[model samples]
Target: MSVMTISEALHEALRGEMLRDPKVFTIGEECGFDGLYGVSTDLEKEFGDKRVIATPISEAGFVGMSVGAAMRGMRPVAELMYIDFIGVCMDQIINQAAKMCYMTGGQVSVPMVLRLPMGSGRRNAGQHSQNLESLLTHIPGLKIVAPITPCDAKGMLTAAIRDDDPVVMLEHKLCYNIRGEVPDGDYTVPFGKAAVRREGTDVTLIGWSRQVLNALEAAEILEKEGISAEVVDIRSLVPLDFDTIAASVSKTGRAVVAQECVNRGGYGGEISAQISENLFGALKAPVVRIGAKNIVPPFAHTLEDAFFPNTADIAAAVRKMMREEGSACG
Candidate 1:
């Protein structure tokens, strides 16, 4: 194993997958060069234009082309510079790539991956800084995965490329520079699996992508207050590992789900509802959700910090949940 940043691990994964499968190619804007967040840096230099094809600033056009290529049995990894731009190509992604396989009575498969750089903390403002994974998770045909660490970033990307259906891989911009130990050579992390980052009995903290790191940090802080918080990372959202989350909540008797997206319709709410529905008797308190405010991501750093849920917010949510005596009545 070698220690590397999430960016480097992603680059290594793309490089390895391209070499392993001649049909696997990447198509997106600025991907042929250094790429946004350095995940595709030096990829085109090694693989050339045929494999690492660069396109114009047309999200709908290029993504439509990627879907067509995937239908023809070619694995295309399309990069959307930001998750916010998904609106420009919703028809291609939600309608075409997602529905083709099922529409053809399972005779055809779209083995494609859409890589998106998401989340806030950078001053990218309202347009560029948004976590829209919840939108994709709502779609029936699409699969969603968010890697919090370098190891999973590499492994999950490899797995997404090899899968038969279209997968949306959400990479947090803040996690690109974070370093961790990643295994050498080709490997894949299976979907519908949850990784327990910390073990405890007091309360369960669940999150994905950068929010997982925040949950981990919150667990550490809660430890000082005599609260043993267990942290679970929901790596894949679509084929969600509800079993792991239910098990954790059952063990802890309380749960607090956190995410960087707005609270109203965030995926964290779905997690909370699932826990409540499946493990109501096991819960000592209502499942709380910690998420960003119901407002656009602000440009100012101070406002941005307040808008997004932080380590303190997670810890506080857990504390509130623990204070309850039994499951909340509807």
Candidate 2:
């Protein structure tokens, strides 16, 4: 019940975990001194170089080291700076960390966490900004968790660290400063569970990361217009809580899945498809998706604004769904 920025909450979570567990250690580029966004600023001073190790600008090598270290009982958390850089270490993440358990017949556990800053609202251009959670989610045995609020960030991160499987924690670039109440004591939000941020009977809006914030704003606007929009923040994408999403859509009869990722082959597509398959009879209209136009995020602020889905776009989508529902009933 304490108000804190998302960054502070996450930092608190890391700090608490490191204190509670001796094996937990974090490694990344500039995460020690630079701390990039300052989430890991005081970490180096408190934990020292042995625990908060900074590495060269080599994703592949460091990621491999993390996996190797995790196999030897170290809870190594590797930060990739931006998610786009994951491509450089795909072999480590995909062939190694992900399949280690199966390859070793459950004798080995890759208890490692890969933290990456993601999303495209900061004009970080095409390479720096991108929601590639869906890509990571595609790989089996890799647990993907993306938290939108301070509470979930702390809770989910703690859970990810304790998990025996490889976890890819994607932190939204724009959600770092979002303020929310976080519990004082230790807490853990289970993975594969979706939390309904706001409930409504008219329509369901599914989003993650910064899009969840955008969806909430749109929900407020829709509420004023008599469109009760339910907002669902998907904390985990891999072990998806589609049941909760389906339940919400069942009651609402309409859905608008949104994300900062591009339209084609995005995670929204998976949700929409699953909902249509499971809740086909209950759906009043086809599930609609609001996302970045299928183009690389531009560097210019205006172009970026035009590319990413905003509150206005979400409101319009909800309005359209409402209109369609009304037409169908009449």
Candidate 3:
């Protein structure tokens, strides 16, 4: 095991995968030597221009090109500087890359990974700080994986790169500097597997990416308040681990789904609805959802703080769920 930041772990994973597989290559903006946020740092020097290719500031062009490369047998890891800019390449991502395999009747597979740096807390303003994972998650052919820790960051990246279909790996910008223990060598955390971060019986808190950290902190706060909160990290949104969530909700009886995205039309709604449908009888109260405000992320620090869901928001949601009187079964 090695203690490393999420950035370092992701860099190592990219390097290891490129070294292991000749087909694996990376193409993105400002990803040559310095890399954006240091996730792809020094990769260009090691792999040279062909493998560590850098593209111009055209998201649509580069993403489309990467899709073609993927269809032609190269496993390209295309980095979108910020997930907010996905609108620029929506055609390529939604129509081409995501639909190629299904459109071709499984004759051709788009084995590519789109790395998106997402979330708020960095005060990157409205355009750069949006958590747009829900948009991609709604698409049918794309597999979405959001890692909250260094271990999952590395493992899931490796898994996404090797996946036969198009995978969208959402990297929370706030998680870049956070340090955690990661394995020394190659490993993969299978998709649809939710990690139980904390054990409790009073309520279940479901979160992904950086929101998982907030959920963990909320769990600690709830612990002190005589409420046991079970925290579950839904690592992959596309291949969601409904079983794990259902099991946890069954044990806890109450649930709160949290995310950094806005509350309306957010991925949390999907999870909460699924819990209601599958485990309604097991629930003691309705599933609560905590997320950012519907407005664009604010540039001001205080507004930004209030915009995104935090530990306080999660704790409050859990408390509210616990305070509910009638059981869902009743």
- Model number with the top lDDT: 1
Q: Give model 2's TM-score versus the native structure.
A: 0.97
Q: List the residue pairs that clash in candidate 1.
A: none
- Tell me each candidate's TM-score: 0.97, 0.97, 0.97
Compose the digit string of candidate 3's lDDT tens values, residues 39-131. Answer: 888888888999988888889998998999999999999998899999999999999998999889999999999999988878899899999
Clashes in predicted model 3: 0
Instruction: Tell me the spans in candidate 1 whose CA falls farther than 4 Å from its real position.
Output: 324-330
Q: How accurate is candidate 3 locally (lDDT)?
A: 0.90
What ranges in model 3 sit over 4 Å off?
326-330
Question: All models: lDDT?
Answer: 0.91, 0.89, 0.90
lDDT string, candidate 1, 15-132, tens digits:
8999999999999998988798887788888889989988999999989999999999899999989999999999999999999988999999999999999989889999999999
| Alpha-carbon RMSD, each predicted model | 1.9, 1.3, 1.7
Worst 10 residues of 1 by lDDT: 321-330
lDDT of 1 at 162: 96
lDDT (10s digit) by residue, model 2, range 48-160: 99999899999999899999999999998888889999999999999999999999999999999999998877789989988888788789989998998899989988998
Off by over 4 Å in 2: 325-330
Clash list (residue pairs), candidate 2:
none
